[model samples]
Target chain A: MAMIDSTRRSFVTRIGGGAGAMALLTVVPHPASAETIDLPERESAILEAAFGSSVLTPGKISLDMPILAETGLSVPVTFKVDSPMTEADHVTRIMGFAPGNPEPVLADYQIGPRAGLAEVSTRIRLARTGFVYAAAKLSDGTLWGTKFSIIVTLGACVEDIFDLDWQRDAERRAMRAEARAAAAAE
Target chain B: MATIRISIPETAAKDEIVEIRTLISHPMDNGYNVDARGQRIPRHILHTFIVTYNGVEVFHANLHPAQSTNPYMVFHTVAVETGTLEFTWLDDDGSVFSDTRTITVQ
Candidate 1:
Protein backbone atom coordinates (compact mmCIF):
# COMPACT_ATOMS: atom_id res chain seq x y z
CA MET A 1 0.00 0.00 0.00
CA ALA A 2 1.11 3.59 -0.66
CA MET A 3 0.33 6.91 0.96
CA ILE A 4 -1.49 9.84 -0.65
CA ASP A 5 0.07 13.23 -0.87
CA SER A 6 -1.92 16.51 -0.98
CA THR A 7 -0.82 17.09 -4.55
CA ARG A 8 -2.37 13.86 -5.79
CA ARG A 9 -5.70 14.77 -4.24
CA SER A 10 -5.75 18.11 -6.00
CA PHE A 11 -4.82 16.42 -9.20
CA VAL A 12 -7.73 14.03 -8.95
CA THR A 13 -10.19 16.77 -7.95
CA ARG A 14 -9.23 18.86 -10.92
CA ILE A 15 -9.82 16.02 -13.35
CA GLY A 16 -13.25 14.63 -12.41
CA GLY A 17 -15.14 12.48 -9.94
CA GLY A 18 -14.61 9.03 -11.48
CA ALA A 19 -11.64 7.23 -10.02
CA GLY A 20 -11.73 3.95 -11.85
CA ALA A 21 -14.57 3.15 -9.48
CA MET A 22 -16.25 1.16 -12.19
CA ALA A 23 -13.03 -0.68 -12.81
CA LEU A 24 -13.55 -2.40 -9.47
CA LEU A 25 -15.20 -5.12 -11.50
CA THR A 26 -11.88 -6.89 -12.18
CA VAL A 27 -10.37 -7.95 -8.84
CA VAL A 28 -7.48 -10.22 -7.89
CA PRO A 29 -8.54 -12.70 -5.20
CA HIS A 30 -6.10 -12.67 -2.27
CA PRO A 31 -6.35 -14.01 1.33
CA ALA A 32 -7.34 -12.14 4.49
CA SER A 33 -4.30 -13.24 6.48
CA ALA A 34 -2.02 -11.62 3.92
CA GLU A 35 -2.96 -8.11 5.07
CA THR A 36 -5.38 -6.21 7.29
CA ILE A 37 -8.21 -6.86 4.80
CA ASP A 38 -11.16 -8.74 6.32
CA LEU A 39 -13.23 -10.77 3.85
CA PRO A 40 -15.94 -13.39 4.37
CA GLU A 41 -14.75 -16.95 3.87
CA ARG A 42 -17.96 -17.85 2.06
CA GLU A 43 -16.60 -16.42 -1.23
CA SER A 44 -14.82 -19.68 -1.88
CA ALA A 45 -17.84 -21.65 -0.72
CA ILE A 46 -19.78 -19.84 -3.41
CA LEU A 47 -17.10 -20.86 -5.88
CA GLU A 48 -17.18 -24.53 -4.90
CA ALA A 49 -20.96 -24.63 -4.95
CA ALA A 50 -20.81 -23.60 -8.57
CA PHE A 51 -17.78 -25.57 -9.73
CA GLY A 52 -16.87 -28.97 -8.37
CA SER A 53 -13.39 -29.96 -7.25
CA SER A 54 -11.07 -29.07 -10.12
CA VAL A 55 -7.43 -29.89 -9.54
CA LEU A 56 -5.22 -26.76 -9.08
CA THR A 57 -1.42 -27.31 -9.13
CA PRO A 58 1.46 -25.03 -8.24
CA GLY A 59 4.52 -23.50 -10.05
CA LYS A 60 2.85 -22.82 -13.45
CA ILE A 61 1.79 -19.12 -13.03
CA SER A 62 3.29 -15.67 -12.42
CA LEU A 63 2.12 -12.31 -10.91
CA ASP A 64 3.90 -9.01 -11.70
CA MET A 65 3.33 -6.35 -8.99
CA PRO A 66 5.36 -3.89 -6.98
CA ILE A 67 7.20 -4.73 -3.79
CA LEU A 68 6.33 -1.21 -2.59
CA ALA A 69 3.83 0.77 -4.63
CA GLU A 70 4.59 4.44 -5.12
CA THR A 71 0.87 5.03 -4.61
CA GLY A 72 -1.71 2.72 -3.11
CA LEU A 73 -4.71 3.86 -5.16
CA SER A 74 -3.23 2.83 -8.52
CA VAL A 75 -0.51 0.30 -9.18
CA PRO A 76 0.81 -1.09 -12.45
CA VAL A 77 0.08 -4.80 -12.82
CA THR A 78 0.70 -7.60 -15.34
CA PHE A 79 -0.14 -11.35 -15.24
CA LYS A 80 1.17 -14.09 -17.55
CA VAL A 81 1.43 -17.88 -17.85
CA ASP A 82 3.37 -20.37 -19.99
CA SER A 83 0.80 -22.87 -21.26
CA PRO A 84 0.42 -24.56 -24.63
CA MET A 85 -2.31 -23.12 -26.89
CA THR A 86 -2.95 -26.10 -29.13
CA GLU A 87 -6.40 -27.68 -29.15
CA ALA A 88 -4.92 -30.48 -27.09
CA ASP A 89 -2.75 -28.20 -24.96
CA HIS A 90 -4.87 -25.03 -24.81
CA VAL A 91 -5.97 -23.28 -21.59
CA THR A 92 -9.59 -22.61 -20.76
CA ARG A 93 -9.61 -19.99 -18.00
CA ILE A 94 -7.41 -17.54 -16.05
CA MET A 95 -8.23 -16.04 -12.62
CA GLY A 96 -6.62 -13.31 -10.45
CA PHE A 97 -6.79 -13.17 -6.62
CA ALA A 98 -5.65 -10.86 -3.81
CA PRO A 99 -6.08 -11.83 -0.16
CA GLY A 100 -6.65 -8.66 1.88
CA ASN A 101 -10.01 -7.36 0.76
CA PRO A 102 -13.65 -7.34 1.87
CA GLU A 103 -14.33 -9.76 -0.99
CA PRO A 104 -11.33 -11.65 -2.29
CA VAL A 105 -12.71 -12.60 -5.72
CA LEU A 106 -11.05 -10.53 -8.41
CA ALA A 107 -11.20 -10.66 -12.22
CA ASP A 108 -11.59 -13.87 -14.25
CA TYR A 109 -10.56 -14.20 -17.93
CA GLN A 110 -11.96 -17.00 -20.09
CA ILE A 111 -9.21 -17.77 -22.60
CA GLY A 112 -8.72 -20.25 -25.39
CA PRO A 113 -6.72 -20.91 -28.64
CA ARG A 114 -7.69 -17.40 -29.86
CA ALA A 115 -5.99 -15.58 -26.96
CA GLY A 116 -2.87 -15.71 -29.14
CA LEU A 117 -0.74 -16.95 -26.23
CA ALA A 118 -1.10 -17.65 -22.51
CA GLU A 119 -0.28 -14.05 -21.56
CA VAL A 120 -2.17 -10.99 -20.19
CA SER A 121 -1.32 -7.59 -18.71
CA THR A 122 -3.44 -4.91 -17.04
CA ARG A 123 -3.54 -2.35 -14.20
CA ILE A 124 -4.90 -3.23 -10.74
CA ARG A 125 -5.27 -1.72 -7.26
CA LEU A 126 -3.42 -3.05 -4.19
CA ALA A 127 -4.46 -2.43 -0.59
CA ARG A 128 -1.90 -4.51 1.25
CA THR A 129 0.79 -7.17 1.26
CA GLY A 130 0.03 -10.89 0.85
CA PHE A 131 0.18 -13.72 -1.64
CA VAL A 132 -1.10 -13.19 -5.21
CA TYR A 133 -1.91 -16.23 -7.32
CA ALA A 134 -2.76 -17.07 -10.92
CA ALA A 135 -4.78 -20.22 -11.60
CA ALA A 136 -5.28 -21.71 -15.04
CA LYS A 137 -7.13 -24.64 -16.61
CA LEU A 138 -5.39 -26.82 -19.18
CA SER A 139 -7.01 -28.74 -22.01
CA ASP A 140 -6.26 -31.97 -20.16
CA GLY A 141 -9.12 -31.15 -17.80
CA THR A 142 -6.90 -30.08 -14.88
CA LEU A 143 -6.06 -26.84 -13.03
CA TRP A 144 -2.59 -25.34 -12.40
CA GLY A 145 -1.35 -22.03 -10.90
CA THR A 146 1.36 -19.93 -9.20
CA LYS A 147 1.48 -17.43 -6.28
CA PHE A 148 3.66 -14.63 -4.85
CA SER A 149 3.57 -12.14 -1.93
CA ILE A 150 3.95 -8.34 -2.04
CA ILE A 151 4.76 -6.23 1.01
CA VAL A 152 3.44 -2.70 1.25
CA THR A 153 1.94 -0.12 3.66
CA LEU A 154 -1.06 1.72 2.17
CA GLY A 155 -4.43 1.47 0.42
CA ALA A 156 -4.64 2.04 -3.37
CA CYS A 157 -8.16 3.21 -4.30
CA VAL A 158 -9.10 5.52 -1.46
CA GLU A 159 -9.23 9.30 -1.73
CA ASP A 160 -10.88 12.50 -0.45
CA ILE A 161 -14.63 13.05 -0.60
CA PHE A 162 -14.50 14.54 -4.11
CA ASP A 163 -11.45 13.03 -5.70
CA LEU A 164 -11.20 11.30 -9.11
CA ASP A 165 -8.77 10.85 -12.04
CA TRP A 166 -7.89 7.16 -11.72
CA GLN A 167 -9.81 6.69 -14.93
CA ARG A 168 -7.93 9.45 -16.70
CA ASP A 169 -4.63 8.07 -15.54
CA ALA A 170 -5.63 4.67 -16.77
CA GLU A 171 -6.61 6.08 -20.15
CA ARG A 172 -3.41 8.04 -20.42
CA ARG A 173 -1.53 4.94 -19.51
CA ALA A 174 -3.25 2.92 -22.22
CA MET A 175 -2.32 5.48 -24.86
CA ARG A 176 1.24 5.69 -23.63
CA ALA A 177 1.50 1.93 -23.76
CA GLU A 178 0.32 1.89 -27.35
CA ALA A 179 2.71 4.68 -28.26
CA ARG A 180 5.62 2.96 -26.58
CA ALA A 181 4.87 -0.34 -28.27
CA ALA A 182 4.73 1.40 -31.64
CA ALA A 183 7.97 3.21 -30.89
CA ALA A 184 9.63 -0.03 -29.89
CA ALA A 185 8.63 -1.75 -33.12
CA GLU A 186 9.78 1.22 -35.16
CA MET B 1 -18.96 -6.29 0.74
CA ALA B 2 -19.60 -6.03 -3.01
CA THR B 3 -21.05 -8.81 -5.09
CA ILE B 4 -18.66 -10.08 -7.79
CA ARG B 5 -20.35 -10.73 -11.11
CA ILE B 6 -19.06 -12.60 -14.19
CA SER B 7 -20.50 -12.81 -17.68
CA ILE B 8 -19.57 -14.36 -21.06
CA PRO B 9 -20.91 -13.08 -24.36
CA GLU B 10 -23.77 -15.26 -25.56
CA THR B 11 -22.93 -14.29 -29.14
CA ALA B 12 -19.58 -16.02 -29.02
CA ALA B 13 -19.27 -18.14 -32.10
CA LYS B 14 -18.43 -21.77 -31.57
CA ASP B 15 -14.68 -22.14 -30.99
CA GLU B 16 -14.42 -18.34 -30.79
CA ILE B 17 -12.65 -16.93 -27.73
CA VAL B 18 -14.73 -14.59 -25.56
CA GLU B 19 -13.57 -12.14 -22.93
CA ILE B 20 -14.51 -12.67 -19.29
CA ARG B 21 -14.83 -9.82 -16.79
CA THR B 22 -15.24 -10.41 -13.04
CA LEU B 23 -15.36 -8.22 -9.96
CA ILE B 24 -15.22 -9.08 -6.22
CA SER B 25 -15.63 -6.63 -3.33
CA HIS B 26 -12.91 -6.78 -0.63
CA PRO B 27 -10.73 -4.28 1.21
CA MET B 28 -7.04 -4.74 0.36
CA ASP B 29 -5.16 -3.84 3.55
CA ASN B 30 -1.49 -3.19 2.80
CA GLY B 31 -0.66 -3.21 6.52
CA TYR B 32 -0.13 0.54 6.25
CA ASN B 33 -3.23 2.28 7.57
CA VAL B 34 -3.89 2.38 11.33
CA ASP B 35 -7.14 2.20 13.20
CA ALA B 36 -8.44 4.57 15.93
CA ARG B 37 -6.22 2.62 18.34
CA GLY B 38 -3.25 3.06 16.03
CA GLN B 39 -2.78 -0.69 16.00
CA ARG B 40 -1.02 -2.37 13.08
CA ILE B 41 -3.70 -4.85 12.06
CA PRO B 42 -2.89 -8.33 10.86
CA ARG B 43 -3.18 -9.61 7.27
CA HIS B 44 -6.29 -11.22 5.77
CA ILE B 45 -6.74 -11.92 2.07
CA LEU B 46 -7.78 -14.23 -0.82
CA HIS B 47 -5.30 -17.00 -1.59
CA THR B 48 -5.96 -18.07 -5.22
CA PHE B 49 -8.72 -18.33 -7.82
CA ILE B 50 -9.76 -21.05 -10.35
CA VAL B 51 -12.12 -20.84 -13.40
CA THR B 52 -13.44 -23.79 -15.32
CA TYR B 53 -15.69 -24.46 -18.27
CA ASN B 54 -18.13 -27.42 -18.45
CA GLY B 55 -16.07 -29.34 -15.85
CA VAL B 56 -12.54 -28.38 -16.73
CA GLU B 57 -10.62 -25.79 -14.67
CA VAL B 58 -9.10 -23.11 -16.92
CA PHE B 59 -7.55 -19.82 -15.73
CA HIS B 60 -6.33 -18.36 -12.39
CA ALA B 61 -4.17 -15.73 -10.50
CA ASN B 62 -2.47 -15.64 -7.03
CA LEU B 63 -3.51 -12.44 -5.19
CA HIS B 64 -1.44 -10.54 -2.66
CA PRO B 65 -2.43 -8.24 0.22
CA ALA B 66 -0.95 -5.39 -1.77
CA GLN B 67 -3.79 -5.72 -4.27
CA SER B 68 -6.63 -3.24 -3.65
CA THR B 69 -9.84 -4.49 -2.07
CA ASN B 70 -12.50 -5.85 -4.38
CA PRO B 71 -9.84 -6.28 -7.02
CA TYR B 72 -11.28 -6.56 -10.53
CA MET B 73 -9.50 -8.75 -13.12
CA VAL B 74 -10.22 -9.30 -16.84
CA PHE B 75 -9.03 -12.20 -19.00
CA HIS B 76 -9.82 -14.06 -22.22
CA THR B 77 -11.29 -17.54 -22.93
CA VAL B 78 -12.74 -19.55 -25.80
CA ALA B 79 -16.17 -21.15 -26.11
CA VAL B 80 -15.45 -24.56 -27.51
CA GLU B 81 -18.73 -26.44 -27.81
CA THR B 82 -21.35 -24.05 -26.38
CA GLY B 83 -21.71 -24.90 -22.71
CA THR B 84 -21.94 -23.06 -19.42
CA LEU B 85 -18.75 -21.39 -18.21
CA GLU B 86 -18.33 -21.87 -14.47
CA PHE B 87 -16.44 -19.15 -12.56
CA THR B 88 -15.29 -19.82 -9.00
CA TRP B 89 -13.57 -17.85 -6.21
CA LEU B 90 -11.30 -19.51 -3.59
CA ASP B 91 -10.62 -17.90 -0.23
CA ASP B 92 -8.08 -18.37 2.54
CA ASP B 93 -10.52 -20.48 4.61
CA GLY B 94 -10.82 -22.82 1.63
CA SER B 95 -14.21 -21.30 0.89
CA VAL B 96 -15.37 -20.65 -2.66
CA PHE B 97 -18.00 -18.44 -4.40
CA SER B 98 -18.90 -19.22 -7.94
CA ASP B 99 -21.34 -18.42 -10.78
CA THR B 100 -22.13 -20.04 -14.10
CA ARG B 101 -22.85 -18.08 -17.27
CA THR B 102 -24.38 -19.74 -20.31
CA ILE B 103 -22.53 -19.32 -23.60
CA THR B 104 -24.51 -19.72 -26.81
CA VAL B 105 -21.58 -20.16 -29.14
CA GLN B 106 -23.00 -19.95 -32.65
Candidate 2:
Protein backbone atom coordinates (compact mmCIF):
# COMPACT_ATOMS: atom_id res chain seq x y z
CA MET A 1 0.00 0.00 0.00
CA ALA A 2 2.86 2.42 0.76
CA MET A 3 4.52 1.81 -2.63
CA ILE A 4 1.21 2.44 -4.48
CA ASP A 5 0.69 5.69 -2.59
CA SER A 6 4.15 6.94 -3.55
CA THR A 7 3.54 6.15 -7.21
CA ARG A 8 0.22 8.05 -7.21
CA ARG A 9 1.83 11.12 -5.61
CA SER A 10 4.56 11.25 -8.28
CA PHE A 11 1.99 10.93 -11.08
CA VAL A 12 -0.07 13.76 -9.68
CA THR A 13 2.98 16.00 -9.32
CA ARG A 14 3.97 15.52 -12.96
CA ILE A 15 0.46 16.33 -14.23
CA GLY A 16 0.22 19.42 -12.00
CA GLY A 17 3.53 20.80 -13.28
CA GLY A 18 2.41 20.43 -16.88
CA ALA A 19 -0.90 22.18 -16.29
CA GLY A 20 0.75 25.00 -14.33
CA ALA A 21 3.11 25.76 -17.18
CA MET A 22 0.20 25.83 -19.63
CA ALA A 23 -1.79 28.13 -17.40
CA LEU A 24 1.11 30.56 -17.15
CA LEU A 25 1.41 30.73 -20.93
CA THR A 26 -2.24 31.80 -21.34
CA VAL A 27 -2.74 33.91 -18.22
CA VAL A 28 -1.80 37.59 -17.85
CA PRO A 29 -4.19 38.68 -15.15
CA HIS A 30 -1.84 40.92 -13.13
CA PRO A 31 -0.15 43.57 -15.22
CA ALA A 32 1.15 45.09 -12.01
CA SER A 33 3.91 42.51 -12.03
CA ALA A 34 4.74 43.08 -15.66
CA GLU A 35 8.31 44.07 -16.55
CA THR A 36 7.48 47.49 -18.05
CA ILE A 37 5.01 48.67 -15.42
CA ASP A 38 6.44 47.43 -12.15
CA LEU A 39 3.60 48.53 -9.95
CA PRO A 40 4.04 47.91 -6.25
CA GLU A 41 1.99 45.09 -4.80
CA ARG A 42 0.09 47.42 -2.49
CA GLU A 43 -0.81 49.75 -5.32
CA SER A 44 -2.01 46.84 -7.39
CA ALA A 45 -4.20 45.68 -4.54
CA ILE A 46 -5.61 49.19 -4.20
CA LEU A 47 -6.43 49.25 -7.88
CA GLU A 48 -8.23 45.95 -7.57
CA ALA A 49 -10.29 47.33 -4.71
CA ALA A 50 -11.02 50.56 -6.56
CA PHE A 51 -12.39 48.74 -9.57
CA GLY A 52 -13.55 45.30 -8.61
CA SER A 53 -13.92 42.70 -11.36
CA SER A 54 -13.17 45.37 -13.92
CA VAL A 55 -10.22 44.84 -16.20
CA LEU A 56 -8.24 48.09 -16.63
CA THR A 57 -6.81 48.63 -20.08
CA PRO A 58 -3.95 51.05 -20.72
CA GLY A 59 -5.63 53.32 -23.19
CA LYS A 60 -7.78 56.42 -23.63
CA ILE A 61 -5.82 58.14 -20.85
CA SER A 62 -3.30 60.90 -21.42
CA LEU A 63 -1.44 61.29 -18.14
CA ASP A 64 0.81 64.35 -17.89
CA MET A 65 3.20 64.12 -14.96
CA PRO A 66 6.86 64.46 -14.15
CA ILE A 67 9.43 61.73 -13.66
CA LEU A 68 10.78 63.44 -10.54
CA ALA A 69 9.00 65.61 -8.00
CA GLU A 70 11.07 68.02 -5.97
CA THR A 71 8.61 67.93 -3.13
CA GLY A 72 5.68 65.73 -2.22
CA LEU A 73 3.59 68.67 -1.09
CA SER A 74 2.21 69.61 -4.50
CA VAL A 75 2.70 67.76 -7.77
CA PRO A 76 0.84 68.94 -10.82
CA VAL A 77 -0.98 66.28 -12.80
CA THR A 78 -3.27 66.42 -15.80
CA PHE A 79 -5.45 63.60 -17.08
CA LYS A 80 -7.47 63.61 -20.28
CA VAL A 81 -9.72 60.89 -21.62
CA ASP A 82 -9.98 60.53 -25.36
CA SER A 83 -13.65 60.01 -26.03
CA PRO A 84 -16.26 61.18 -28.46
CA MET A 85 -18.61 63.21 -26.28
CA THR A 86 -21.70 62.25 -28.15
CA GLU A 87 -25.16 61.44 -26.87
CA ALA A 88 -24.48 57.78 -27.50
CA ASP A 89 -21.01 57.47 -25.89
CA HIS A 90 -18.95 59.49 -23.41
CA VAL A 91 -16.82 59.24 -20.32
CA THR A 92 -18.86 59.00 -17.16
CA ARG A 93 -16.27 59.46 -14.46
CA ILE A 94 -12.56 59.75 -13.74
CA MET A 95 -10.74 58.81 -10.54
CA GLY A 96 -7.21 59.26 -9.24
CA PHE A 97 -5.66 56.84 -6.75
CA ALA A 98 -2.51 57.02 -4.66
CA PRO A 99 -1.58 53.73 -3.11
CA GLY A 100 1.06 55.04 -0.75
CA ASN A 101 -1.07 57.78 0.79
CA PRO A 102 -3.12 57.20 3.93
CA GLU A 103 -6.21 57.52 1.77
CA PRO A 104 -5.79 55.45 -1.34
CA VAL A 105 -8.31 57.51 -3.31
CA LEU A 106 -7.04 61.00 -4.08
CA ALA A 107 -9.88 62.36 -6.15
CA ASP A 108 -13.05 61.32 -8.00
CA TYR A 109 -14.72 63.22 -10.83
CA GLN A 110 -18.12 62.65 -12.35
CA ILE A 111 -18.81 63.57 -15.94
CA GLY A 112 -21.76 63.19 -18.26
CA PRO A 113 -22.79 63.43 -21.87
CA ARG A 114 -23.36 67.12 -21.28
CA ALA A 115 -19.63 67.43 -20.74
CA GLY A 116 -18.28 68.26 -24.15
CA LEU A 117 -14.81 67.08 -23.11
CA ALA A 118 -13.27 64.96 -20.37
CA GLU A 119 -10.17 66.42 -18.73
CA VAL A 120 -8.89 67.63 -15.36
CA SER A 121 -5.72 69.23 -13.99
CA THR A 122 -4.80 69.59 -10.34
CA ARG A 123 -2.01 69.23 -7.81
CA ILE A 124 -1.89 66.19 -5.51
CA ARG A 125 0.12 65.34 -2.43
CA LEU A 126 2.25 62.22 -2.32
CA ALA A 127 3.36 60.52 0.86
CA ARG A 128 6.39 58.95 -0.76
CA THR A 129 8.00 58.04 -4.02
CA GLY A 130 5.43 55.94 -5.82
CA PHE A 131 3.16 55.66 -8.82
CA VAL A 132 -0.17 57.39 -9.53
CA TYR A 133 -3.00 55.59 -11.27
CA ALA A 134 -5.83 57.31 -13.11
CA ALA A 135 -8.87 55.44 -14.35
CA ALA A 136 -11.79 56.59 -16.47
CA LYS A 137 -15.10 54.82 -16.63
CA LEU A 138 -17.05 55.03 -19.85
CA SER A 139 -20.76 55.03 -20.41
CA ASP A 140 -20.61 51.41 -21.54
CA GLY A 141 -19.16 50.16 -18.24
CA THR A 142 -15.62 49.93 -19.59
CA LEU A 143 -12.73 51.20 -17.48
CA TRP A 144 -9.51 52.54 -19.01
CA GLY A 145 -6.47 53.53 -17.03
CA THR A 146 -2.91 54.83 -17.13
CA LYS A 147 -0.10 55.15 -14.60
CA PHE A 148 3.13 57.09 -14.06
CA SER A 149 5.93 56.76 -11.53
CA ILE A 150 7.37 59.71 -9.65
CA ILE A 151 10.43 60.01 -7.47
CA VAL A 152 9.89 62.25 -4.45
CA THR A 153 12.90 64.02 -3.01
CA LEU A 154 11.12 65.35 0.07
CA GLY A 155 8.30 63.26 1.40
CA ALA A 156 5.07 64.73 2.82
CA CYS A 157 2.44 63.59 5.32
CA VAL A 158 4.95 62.66 7.97
CA GLU A 159 3.02 62.59 11.24
CA ASP A 160 5.86 62.84 13.68
CA ILE A 161 6.62 66.49 14.30
CA PHE A 162 10.16 65.68 15.35
CA ASP A 163 10.89 64.25 11.92
CA LEU A 164 10.32 67.56 10.14
CA ASP A 165 12.99 70.20 9.55
CA TRP A 166 12.85 73.79 10.70
CA GLN A 167 11.83 75.09 7.30
CA ARG A 168 9.14 72.50 6.79
CA ASP A 169 7.85 73.02 10.29
CA ALA A 170 7.71 76.72 9.73
CA GLU A 171 5.87 76.17 6.47
CA ARG A 172 3.30 74.05 8.20
CA ARG A 173 2.75 76.71 10.82
CA ALA A 174 2.34 79.37 8.16
CA MET A 175 -0.13 77.26 6.28
CA ARG A 176 -2.16 76.81 9.42
CA ALA A 177 -2.10 80.52 10.07
CA GLU A 178 -3.22 81.20 6.55
CA ALA A 179 -6.05 78.75 6.88
CA ARG A 180 -7.22 80.44 10.04
CA ALA A 181 -7.01 83.87 8.45
CA ALA A 182 -9.07 82.69 5.52
CA ALA A 183 -11.65 81.27 7.84
CA ALA A 184 -11.89 84.54 9.72
CA ALA A 185 -12.20 86.51 6.50
CA GLU A 186 -15.09 84.37 5.40
CA MET B 1 -20.29 81.89 0.98
CA ALA B 2 -16.99 81.86 -0.97
CA THR B 3 -15.25 84.00 -3.54
CA ILE B 4 -13.95 82.60 -6.84
CA ARG B 5 -11.48 83.84 -9.46
CA ILE B 6 -11.11 82.52 -13.01
CA SER B 7 -8.49 83.06 -15.69
CA ILE B 8 -9.12 82.34 -19.37
CA PRO B 9 -7.64 83.89 -22.46
CA GLU B 10 -9.82 86.54 -23.97
CA THR B 11 -9.13 85.47 -27.54
CA ALA B 12 -8.09 82.28 -29.31
CA ALA B 13 -7.95 80.97 -32.84
CA LYS B 14 -10.50 78.49 -34.10
CA ASP B 15 -9.95 74.98 -32.76
CA GLU B 16 -7.36 76.28 -30.34
CA ILE B 17 -7.03 74.53 -27.04
CA VAL B 18 -7.10 77.20 -24.34
CA GLU B 19 -6.14 76.85 -20.73
CA ILE B 20 -8.55 77.59 -17.88
CA ARG B 21 -7.50 78.26 -14.32
CA THR B 22 -9.72 78.65 -11.26
CA LEU B 23 -9.06 79.55 -7.65
CA ILE B 24 -11.49 79.67 -4.76
CA SER B 25 -10.99 81.14 -1.30
CA HIS B 26 -12.12 78.59 1.26
CA PRO B 27 -10.43 76.56 3.96
CA MET B 28 -11.07 72.93 2.99
CA ASP B 29 -11.40 71.83 6.64
CA ASN B 30 -10.55 68.08 6.48
CA GLY B 31 -11.95 67.37 9.97
CA TYR B 32 -8.86 65.36 10.85
CA ASN B 33 -7.18 68.00 12.93
CA VAL B 34 -7.95 68.49 16.59
CA ASP B 35 -8.31 71.85 18.32
CA ALA B 36 -6.30 73.07 21.29
CA ARG B 37 -8.82 71.29 23.53
CA GLY B 38 -8.35 68.10 21.50
CA GLN B 39 -11.84 68.26 20.01
CA ARG B 40 -12.19 66.89 16.49
CA ILE B 41 -12.94 69.45 13.81
CA PRO B 42 -15.83 68.75 11.53
CA ARG B 43 -15.01 68.39 7.83
CA HIS B 44 -16.21 71.14 5.54
CA ILE B 45 -14.92 71.04 1.98
CA LEU B 46 -15.90 71.90 -1.55
CA HIS B 47 -17.74 68.93 -2.87
CA THR B 48 -17.75 69.56 -6.62
CA PHE B 49 -16.36 71.78 -9.37
CA ILE B 50 -17.99 72.23 -12.73
CA VAL B 51 -17.12 74.18 -15.87
CA THR B 52 -19.51 74.94 -18.67
CA TYR B 53 -18.86 76.56 -22.04
CA ASN B 54 -21.60 77.78 -24.35
CA GLY B 55 -24.22 76.12 -22.16
CA VAL B 56 -22.47 72.71 -22.35
CA GLU B 57 -20.45 71.04 -19.66
CA VAL B 58 -16.74 70.63 -20.37
CA PHE B 59 -15.04 69.49 -17.17
CA HIS B 60 -16.08 68.46 -13.66
CA ALA B 61 -14.42 67.27 -10.46
CA ASN B 62 -15.58 65.78 -7.18
CA LEU B 63 -13.11 67.07 -4.65
CA HIS B 64 -12.01 65.24 -1.51
CA PRO B 65 -10.98 66.43 1.92
CA ALA B 66 -7.33 65.87 1.08
CA GLN B 67 -7.37 68.92 -1.16
CA SER B 68 -5.59 72.03 0.06
CA THR B 69 -7.19 74.97 1.86
CA ASN B 70 -7.76 77.21 -1.17
CA PRO B 71 -8.44 74.86 -4.08
CA TYR B 72 -6.81 75.67 -7.39
CA MET B 73 -7.52 73.80 -10.62
CA VAL B 74 -6.33 74.26 -14.17
CA PHE B 75 -7.78 72.56 -17.21
CA HIS B 76 -8.01 72.89 -20.97
CA THR B 77 -10.85 73.13 -23.45
CA VAL B 78 -11.16 73.63 -27.17
CA ALA B 79 -12.16 77.11 -28.29
CA VAL B 80 -14.66 76.20 -30.96
CA GLU B 81 -16.66 79.39 -30.79
CA THR B 82 -17.08 82.61 -28.84
CA GLY B 83 -19.13 82.02 -25.73
CA THR B 84 -19.28 82.33 -21.96
CA LEU B 85 -17.12 79.98 -19.89
CA GLU B 86 -18.62 79.49 -16.47
CA PHE B 87 -16.97 78.04 -13.35
CA THR B 88 -19.03 76.81 -10.42
CA TRP B 89 -17.91 75.43 -7.07
CA LEU B 90 -20.22 73.70 -4.61
CA ASP B 91 -19.51 73.66 -0.90
CA ASP B 92 -20.57 71.25 1.81
CA ASP B 93 -22.79 73.89 3.42
CA GLY B 94 -25.14 74.01 0.46
CA SER B 95 -23.52 77.14 -0.97
CA VAL B 96 -22.45 77.61 -4.55
CA PHE B 97 -19.86 80.10 -5.91
CA SER B 98 -19.72 80.92 -9.60
CA ASP B 99 -17.65 83.08 -11.98
CA THR B 100 -17.62 83.48 -15.73
CA ARG B 101 -15.38 84.76 -18.52
CA THR B 102 -15.99 85.43 -22.20
CA ILE B 103 -13.78 84.03 -24.96
CA THR B 104 -13.51 85.21 -28.53
CA VAL B 105 -12.39 83.02 -31.45
CA GLN B 106 -10.27 84.67 -34.11
Index of the highest-TM-score prediction: 2
Across all candidates, what is each one's fraction of true contacts kept? 0.20, 0.39
Model 1 per-residue lDDT tens digits across residues A1-186: 012232563455346442433211122333434432222355345334323433345545555555455554655555556676877787666666665543454545566665546666545655556655556666776656556566546655343111345466456556867887899999
True interface contacts retained by model 2: 0.39
What tens-digit string does per-residue lDDT give for candidate 2 at A1-186? 111232454465466753442111111122545423334566557556655633577677656555567776666666678888666898887887777665656677776655456766677767678777777788887877777667777654544223335467557767878888899999
Chain B TM, every candidate: 0.85, 0.95
- Which residue pairs in candidate 2 have backbone atoms (N, alpha carbon, C) closer than 3 angstroms, thus clashing? none
Model 1 chain A weakest lDDT span, ten residues long: A20-29
**Candidate 2: regions farther than 4 A off:** A1-53, A67-71, A82-92, A111-119, A138-141, A151-156, A160-186, B1-3, B34-40
Query: What TM-score would every model get versus the actual structure?
Result: 0.47, 0.63
Best by lDDT: 2
> For candidate 1, lDDT tens digit of each residue in B1-106?
3477774587777767566767776665544444553344455556565677778766656665545567666666667767777767766656676778887777
TM-score (2 decimals) of chain A in model 1: 0.56
What value does the lDDT take at residue A80 in candidate 2? Answer: 71
